[model samples]
Structures are given as C-alpha cells and as structure tokens.
Target: MDTYSFLRQLADSWALLALTLFFLGTIVWAFRPGSRDVHNDVADIPFRNETVPVDDADTPDTGAKS
Candidate 1:
C-alpha cells in the first residue's frame, strides 16, 4: 500500500483508539479519589487575597477622565 493509505488507516483506527483512551484516562485521573484538597486549593486561587482589600493608591492612574 502507498504511504497515504497506510497513514489514513492508522489514523482511522489506532490513532482514534489512542486518542479516545487518552481522553478517558485524563478524565479518570482528574476525578480520582483523594484529590479534593488539591482541586479545592486551585479553585480558591481567585479568592486567596479576599481578606486583604485592595487600596486605590496602589492602582496605576489611567489618564482617561471618568
């Protein structure tokens, strides 16, 4: 068979199966047990500095008049 045909068959079968397995494996790994604390820490990243209110003096002044 020609190179194109060989590559096409590989993509149609083995490549597809490999990609599907990789996707499922990622999902399983992300949702596995004992990962709650890690996930929660990452989720709270935005609110990490909530206790400290931002001061307006620390902000850069944009010349545009409000």
Candidate 2:
C-alpha cells in the first residue's frame, strides 16, 4: 500500500480509538473520588479574598471630575 493509504487507514482506526480513550480517561480523572476539595478550592479562587477590604491607595486616579 502507498504511504497515503497507510496513514489514512491508521487515522481511521487507531487514531480514533486513541482519541476516544484519551477523552474518557480525562473525564474519569476529573471526576475521580476524593477530588471535591481540590475542585472547590480552585472554584473559590475568585472569591477567596472577597472579605478583604480594597485599599484606596491601590486605585489610580484618572483625574476625571465626579
């Protein structure tokens, strides 16, 4: 068989199977047991400092009249 035909056959079979397995493995890894705490921590990153008050010194004055 020619190179093109061989590559096409490989992509049509093994490549598809490999990609499907990879997708399933990723899903399984993400939803595995004992991972809720890690996921929750990452999810709360934006709100982690919510209780802290913002300092006015950190704000840049644009000099626009109120």
Candidate 3:
C-alpha cells in the first residue's frame, strides 16, 4: 500500500470518528450536572463589566474645547 492511500484511509475513518467523539464529549460536558454556577458566572461577565466604574486616569485628554 502506498503512503498516500494509507493516510487517506486513516483520515477518512479514524479522524472522522475522533472529531465526532470530541464534539459529543464537548456537548455532554457543557450540559452535565453541577455546572450551572460556572455557566451562570460566564453568562454574567458582560453585566459585571458594566457594573465596574471606569477610572478617569485611564482616559486620554482630547485637548480640545468641549
């Protein structure tokens, strides 16, 4: 068997199976029990950012009349 043929067969079979299993595992991990708090924290990150006060020192002065 030539190297190209062997690699092609391996990719067509094992690679496909590996990718499918990885996808399913990710889905299972995402929806598993006892993960609600972590997911909630991630979901609230945008709202948390809004609550933080911005420091004036970080702002640049435009040096123009308002």
Candidate 4:
C-alpha cells in the first residue's frame, strides 16, 4: 500500500531473482566450450550423399541425350 511496504515486498519476491538466474544460465551456456572440429563447419546443413533409389522404373536411359 505504501512505498516502503511495496518496495520491501518487491525485494522479497522471486521475479528479479528468477530473471538474474536466467541471464546467468544464458551466459554460462554461451561460454561453455567445445571445439566443433572441421566436421561441423555448417550449423543447419542437411547431409547429402551416396543413398539413391535404383528402381528400374525410375532409371533414365543411358543412351539418350537431351
């Protein structure tokens, strides 16, 4: 109801504490170290390679050229 009471109530509450811990966790996670080696150079890339369907119906005639 009054300034002192309101401020005392705020001081005892968890909102600021929760906010501080959230920021600290964010900072710690950001600084946590691990080398990504050369393999992870691209973050969101999808892997592409040797898997392909070889069904006869899907084949392109090797002798034909367009």
Candidate 4 per-residue lDDT, tens place, 26-47, comes to 8877666763533365543564
Model 1 Cα lDDT, one tens digit per residue, 1-66:
999999999999999999999999999999999889999999999988787666889789988987
The full ranking of all candidates by lDDT, starting with the best, is: 2, 1, 3, 4
| Residues 1-66 of candidate 2: C-alpha lDDT, one tens digit per residue | 999999999999999999999999999999999999999999999987687667879889989887
Give me the runs in candidate 2 sitting further than 4 Å from their true place.
51-66
How well does each candidate superpose onto the true structure, as a TM-score? 0.74, 0.73, 0.70, 0.37
Local distance difference test values of all predictions, in order: 0.95, 0.95, 0.94, 0.72
Candidate 1 TM-score, C-alpha based = 0.74
The alpha-carbon deviation from the true structure for residue 46 of candidate 2, after best TM-score superposition, in angstroms, is 0.9
lDDT of 2: 0.95
For each of the candidates, the C-alpha root-mean-square deviation to the true structure, in angstroms, is 4.7, 4.2, 5.1, 7.4
Q: By TM-score, how accurate is candidate 2?
A: 0.73
- By TM-score, rank the candidates, best first: 1, 2, 3, 4
What is candidate 3's lDDT per residue for 12-61, written digit by digit as tens? 99999999999999999999999999999999988875766668898889
Weakest lDDT window of 10 consecutive positions for candidate 4: 35-44
Candidate 1 ranges beyond 4 A from true positions: 51-66
Q: For model 3, what is the error of residue 66's alpha carbon versus the real structure, in angstroms, after optimal superposition?
A: 16
